[model samples]
Target: MKRIHDSLIVQTMSRLLIPLAQLFALYVLFFGQYGPGGGFVAGVIWTTSMILTFLVFGLKSPQGRLVEKVLHGDGVGLIIFVGVGGLCLIGGGEFLNYANLEIPGLDAPARRYMGILLGQIGVAVDVAVTGISIVLSLAYHDIEQEYHV
Candidate 1:
């Protein structure tokens, strides 16, 4: 993609930014397990990374790359989210009860951990979609120029 603002400064900022965004997202997702975040946080985090990439790299090409990754990840995350429901049914315990199945080696508490993990994957998709859509719409307006109705 073309660099943003036609400036070396923007390019440099982006090169530094993308990874930090990802790391922060992961932190949010995992930290949610303890506080109030989870899959949604992860998804948002993914989106944020893409957005920063686009903001720094420029819209056309950068946006495409981000969208492509989001689409692919969204698909995989969605399948897993659905699959978790299937597991819930087989394991028995309402829709998402993971407690009924004997995981062979895992204890009861550990089963809960697994369930949370699965759920978070679903949440990640949600956050990512939000970020991607927001960035996409923003691309329509040229920040350096004014928009007219």
Candidate 2:
């Protein structure tokens, strides 16, 4: 991570923005119980941070490699989706029904909320990686519109 003083606007913004994104993501995660902005928003926010991180850090390493990282995340997201769906498949009621399902240590409503968040997080990862992949793809094939012949 680049230090604050040496950071360019991109780096500075990336560092600042990731945390802010996470803050809001968690806010949406928790606050959704009473209000709106639950799992979906949180997932989007969570994934977006990765995109920003890639932009700032240039995506050189394993962790920053959106394509590779996203590959694994896709499976993760799928598993979460299916898990929630399975809960509904059983006598648990609707998909991710926290009220009826009885899993120890996790409250029914809380569990449902958590389930929503997990699903959203999976979506966010997919979105962010897709965004990064698009950027990379475009980098390979420049439109050259700005260049004068």
Candidate 3:
């Protein structure tokens, strides 16, 4: 693997920008319901940040561990999506019928909003995990080829 200090300026800049990029990704995720940015864009940003980390720090770095965690979490989004649908079905409504969720403390609109937010979160997690998994596999393959050659 290449040294972290391959270029002083590049190292410093990437280190600084990575966190900011991740923060912006989160911002895009939360504001997606109201604006243009959403799960897909947020997932792209997440993939970009992970790839940048791998490029800068190499495969053996902490970023690799993070990628592994992401892989493990890959199915979480799907589970959430299905779980929500199941809950609706159990509530005697059609699949994904947010209106059927009855929380005594909150009104129908609030329940619907919560359901939408959960669905969006599931999508975001699914997309981000898939993107990260692809990038990690490619990175691993490249490294394996490099070492074998």
Candidate 4:
């Protein structure tokens, strides 16, 4: 079977669509809490775009290198997610309670909003990185089998 990266049409469409998909993912990430989408949906959208790029451009592509650079971001995301809850504890509230998040300039409602947003961002980052890592590992396994490495 022919590899997907050999198709010029697919390459062109992927190059065009990847950025748009990422932008839409951001839109979903931010506005999701207010409406129909959320962190999980945003993460899936972003990961799908990365997967499309990987399939169309191969593992040596620039975007693939970028993914490698960010492979450790899952830990950072987890930290952010946990840190928000920790902040709530510091503010004299129970774990994961957004209402008690204390910021110097924000009132209770604003602090809660910020806490929720931060938690969502953390979840999105974790999910995106985890998904990309899985895809990369699978691709590496395929390459190893092909080359008997």
Winning candidate number (TM-score): 4
- C-alpha RMSD in Å of predicted model 4 compared with the true structure: 2.3
The 10 consecutive residues of candidate 3 with the worst lDDT sum are: 1-10
Error of 2 at 27 (Å): 2.0
Q: Cα deviation in Å at residue 129, candidate 2?
A: 5.4
Q: Give the least accurate 10-residue stretch of model 1, judged by summed lDDT.
A: 140-149
Top-lDDT candidate index: 4
Note the Cα lDDT for every prediction shown. 0.68, 0.59, 0.77, 0.82
**Every model's TM-score:** 0.74, 0.60, 0.85, 0.88
lDDT accuracy of residue 44 in candidate 4: 83
Output the better candidate (1/4) by TM-score.
Answer: 4
Better of 2 and 3 by lDDT: 3
| lDDT of predicted model 1 | 0.68
Clashes of each: 7, 0, 0, 0
Return the candidate ranking by TM-score, descending: 4, 3, 1, 2
Return the TM-score for candidate 3, rounded to 2 decimals: 0.85
What are the RMSD figures for all models against the true structure? 4.8, 6.6, 2.6, 2.3
Query: What is the per-residue lDDT of model 1 for residues 1-149, given as tens digits with 9 covering 90 to 100?
Result: 23355688877776787788888878878787688767886777678777767666554464546564564453666667767767767876666676644467887688878877777877687668756766665555563342231
For model 2, the local distance difference test gives 0.59
